[model samples]
Target: MTVMELSNLSVTLRRRDVIRDVSLSVGKGEFIGLIGPNGAGKTTLMRAALGLIPFVGNSSLAAMPLAERAMAVAWMPQQREIAWPVTVETLVMLGRTPHVGALASPTDHDRSQVDAAIRWMGLDDMRQRAATRLSGGEQARVLIARALAQDTPFVMADEPVAGLDPAHQISTMQTFARLAEQGKSSLVSLHDLGLAARHCTRLVLMSEGRLIADGCPAHVLTPERLAEVFGISAWYQDTEQGPVCQPLEVIR
Candidate 1:
C-alpha cells in the first residue's frame, strides 16, 4: 500500500515558488532519505505532505484524502529555540494529543507509550530532566521520542540529526531503520550523504525546489551527480561500512 502520495505538488510563499511540480509516492515500510542543499524546499515539501502549507497539488496518506493527513503522519522538525522547561517525559507525552479526546487527561496507555518512547530513544536516564537543560544531541533524541510516541503510520523528519555528533547521528539513523523494519514508513531529510546512503532504503535528491533523483542511494549518489547538484567534487566508494562520500574540494 502507498503510505503517502503527492501529485503535482507545488508550494509558493509570498508569490515565490519554493516547490514546483513535485510528485512522489512512498510505499508502506519504505525509509526514504531526502537530500538537498539549503533553500531547496525540502522542508516545504515535508510541510506540504503534512498538509501544513497551502499548495496547489494533491497529497494523500494511506489512501485517505488530505484532510486527515496529519492524523496518520507524524512530523519532527529541526530543533529550534524551545523555551518551555518541561520534563522530557512530559514533552514526549504531548505526542498523544492527536489521539486523545478534547480536554481529557492522558491515560495509562499514553503514559506507557511515552515511557517506551523514552527508552527507545535511550533517554531513560534523562526522563525526569528538564528539556531546556539537556545537550543539543540529547534534545534531538527527545524530540524524536516525542514523534515516536505519536504512533503514526508515516513519520517525517526534517534534519533529524543536524547537530548531533557522529555517534549520536548513527544511533538516530539506526533507530529510524528499526522503526521502518517494524513496518512504519519514514521520510527523513538529511544532509549527510554517507549516513543516508547507509541507512535509507531509497534516496530522493532535490535542488532548487526540484527533485533531481529518486532511487537506491548507491546508484543515485554518484560523484558526477553529487557535483552537478551540490557543486562539490566528490568520489563515492563502497566500503565495509557502506558507501562513503568523499568530497575532494569545492567546484567553483
Candidate 2:
C-alpha cells in the first residue's frame, strides 16, 4: 500500500522555487533516503510532505487531506540545540500530541506508549534525565523515541544524524531500518552518502528543486551521476561488508 504520495509538488521560499514538479509514491515498510547537497531542496521537499510549509500541488498521507494527515504521519526535524529543561521522558511524551484531545490529559495507554518508545530507543536509563543534559547522540535518540511514540504508520526525518559520532550514526540508521522492516514507511534525509547507500532500500536524489534520480543504490548513485549532480568525483564499490562509496576529489 502507498503510505505517502506527492504529485507535481512545488515549494517556494522568498519568491524563489525550492522544490518543483517533484512527485513520489512511498510504499508501506519502505526505507527511503533523500540525498542532495546543501540547499538542494531535500529539506524543502520533506517540509512540503509534512505540510510544514505552503506548497503548490497535491500531497496526501494515507490518501487523507493535508490538514488531516498528521494523524498518520509523524516528523522529526534535524536535531537542534534544545533549551527547555524538560526530562527525556517528557520530551518523548510530546509525540502523543496528535492522538490526545486538546483539553485531555494523557491516559494509561499514552504513558505505556511513551515507555515503550523510550525502551525501544535504548533510552530507558535516561528517562528521568533532563533532555538538555544529554549528549548529542543521546538527544538524537530521544527525539527518535518521541517520533516512535507517535505510533504513526509513516515517519519523515530531516538530517536525523547531523551531529552524532560514527558509531551512533550507524546505530540510528539501523534503528530506522528495523522500523521499516516492522511495517512502517520511513523517509530520512541524509548527507552521508555512504550511510544512505548502505542502509536505504531506495534512494531519492534531488537538486535545484528537481528530482534527479530515484532507484536502487547501485543504479542511481553512479560516478557519472554523482559528478553531475553532486559536483564531486566518486566511485561506489561492493565489499564483503557492503557497498562503499569513495569520493576521489573535487571534479574541478
Candidate 3:
C-alpha cells in the first residue's frame, strides 16, 4: 500500500528552484534512501514532502491536516542539537504528543510505546541520562528513538546518521531496515553510499533538484551513474553481509 505519494513536486526558494519536478512514492515495508550530492535538493524535497516548505505539487502526506499529518508521518530532520536538560526517556516520550492530546497526560500505552522505541535504538541504559549530556552520536540515536516512538505509518529523515561512529552507524541503519520488515516505510537521506547500498530497499538518486535514478541499490549505484553524478569510481558487489560500494577514486 502506498503510504506516501508525490507527483510533479517542485519547490522554489528566493526565486531559485531548489527542488524541480519530481515524483516519487513510498509504500509499506519499504526503506528508501534519498541520495544526492550537497545542493542537489535532498533536504528540500523532504521538507516539501513534509509540508515544511512551500511547494507546487501533490503530496499525500503534505496535503493532510496538521494534526492528521502528525499521525501519518514521523519527521526526523537534520538538526541534532539538544539543549534541554530533560532525561532521555522524557524526551522520547514527547513523540506521543499527537496521540495524547494537548491537554491530556500520557497513558500507559504511550509509555510502553516510548519504552519499545528506546529498546529498538539500544538506548535503554541511557533512559535516565540528561539528553544534553550525551555525545553527539548518542544524541542522534536518542532523537531517532523519539521518532520511532511516534509509531507513524511512515518516517522521513534527513541525514539521520551523520555524526555516528561505524558501529553505531551500522546499528542505526539496521534499525530502519528492521522497521521496513515490520511493515513501516522510511525515507532517509544519506551520503554514505555503502550504507545506502547495504540496507536500503530502494534508492532515489537526485541531482540539481531532479531525480536522476531510482531503483534497487545495485541498479541505482551503477558505475556510470556514480562517476557522473558523484564524480567518483566505486567498486561495488553483493556480499552475504549486503551490497557494498567502496569508492576507488574521484573521476578526473
Measured with C-alpha atoms, the lDDT of residue 117 in candidate 3 is 94
Candidate 1 ranges with C-alpha deviation above 4 Å = 61-67
**Model 3 Cα lDDT, one tens digit per residue, 44-68:** 9999998888999899988899999
Clashes of 1: 0
Winning model by TM-score:
3
> In terms of TM-score, which candidate is stronger, 2 or 3?
3
> What order do you get sorting by lDDT, best first?
3, 2, 1
Model 3 error, position 163 (Å): 0.4
Clashing pairs in 3: none
RMSD of candidate 1 to the truth, in angstroms, is 2.0
Question: How well does candidate 1 score on lDDT at residue 34?
Answer: 96
lDDT of 1 by residue, 71-160 (tens): 788889875555799999989988888877779999999998898889888999999999999988889899999999998888999999
lDDT of each: 0.87, 0.88, 0.94
